[model samples]
Target: MPKKALIAWGGWPGHTPEQSAKVVRSLLERNGFDVTLGEGTVMFADPKLASFDLIVPVITMSTIEKAELQNLVLAVRQGSGLGGFHGTMCDSFRSETDYQFMTGGQWVAHPGDIIDYTVAVTRPDDPITSGVSDFAYRSEQYYMHVDPGNEVLATTTFTDAHFPGIGGVVMPVVWKRRYGAGKVFYSALGHNADEFAVPEMALIVERGLVWAAR
Candidate 1:
């Protein structure tokens, strides 16, 4: 049987949550997953949430309930793989430290929002980043509060282009971390459906999704 996958989208729609969810649904299905979709944080509280092999949150700046967060975090801790991109995962629950702890980062700001930047693959040998060359990208340059334990695969350096005096600050663009027995992966790429068109962005997120699933 194919592995089970759940994708839930909600909160701010500016990120095009529905479209993002659909893109991921297609990708997961193509990778032989039994995909399920949910809207809002309601699904996060589902008692059976941990049954899936992977969970993807296409959410942004949404408030999550205590029960919902507890269940979701517990799911990952008990081995439900979690994967997502941009603000979808990391920026979802602003008030939940546990969620941030599990996801490995929180979106603090996107300096120079949607401008040209370079994504440098730090771990070229990692499966999720292998064969993906450093590429020019036009999207949010995420400045985040990231986990020190994360295994960073790709990064981008900030310049004083938009925010002055912050030059030479390298930030993790893609990373994977362990939350209990679960595999957690995130890419600071894919701000919208259009970004998935970029080969480098698409490749990193696609491979990262597959790599995160149990």
Candidate 2:
């Protein structure tokens, strides 16, 4: 049987979680995974979620209950894969301490309008990023506060499009972390449906899901 995948999308509608999740869900299905989607706040409530092969959060930013967080974190630590992009996985949970720790980073600011930003792949030899050389997108340049020990897979340089980018900044755009025994893979792209709609971006997201699930 195909591996099970659950995508929980919530937080900000401006970022269009539901729509973006559909795109991601499709990508997973195309790769032969059994996928499902939950809207708004149901992610933290599903008790059986821990049994799934993967968890993909499309959330932007919000506070989550402590018990809910505990369950999710513990599930990942038990070996389930967790993967997603943008504020959903990284910049999310402004007020939640536990949530922030699991993600390995937080989006502190995005100086300019959601314009194109260039993403530079750091560890090109990694399975998720190896074949991908460099790609640029007209989206927000994520200024993140990252965890020091993460296995960084990709990064981006800040240009004049955003300030506080002083002398140029090299920020991790994609990374993986081991929380207990679980594998976490995150991509700082996919701010919208169109972002993941790109063939290359979609492939990246798909590979990330498969990689994390392993």
Best by TM-score: 1
RMSD, every candidate, angstroms: 0.7, 1.6
Error of 1 at 202 (Å): 1.1
Q: Clashes in each model (backbone N, CA, C under 3 Å)? A: 0, 7
Residue-level lDDT for 189 in candidate 1: 94
User: Candidates' TM-scores?
Assistant: 0.98, 0.93
Worst 10 residues of 2 by lDDT: 158-167
* Runs in model 2 lying further than 4 Å from the true structure: none
Give model 2's TM-score versus the native structure: 0.93
Residue 24: error of model 1 in Å? Answer: 0.3
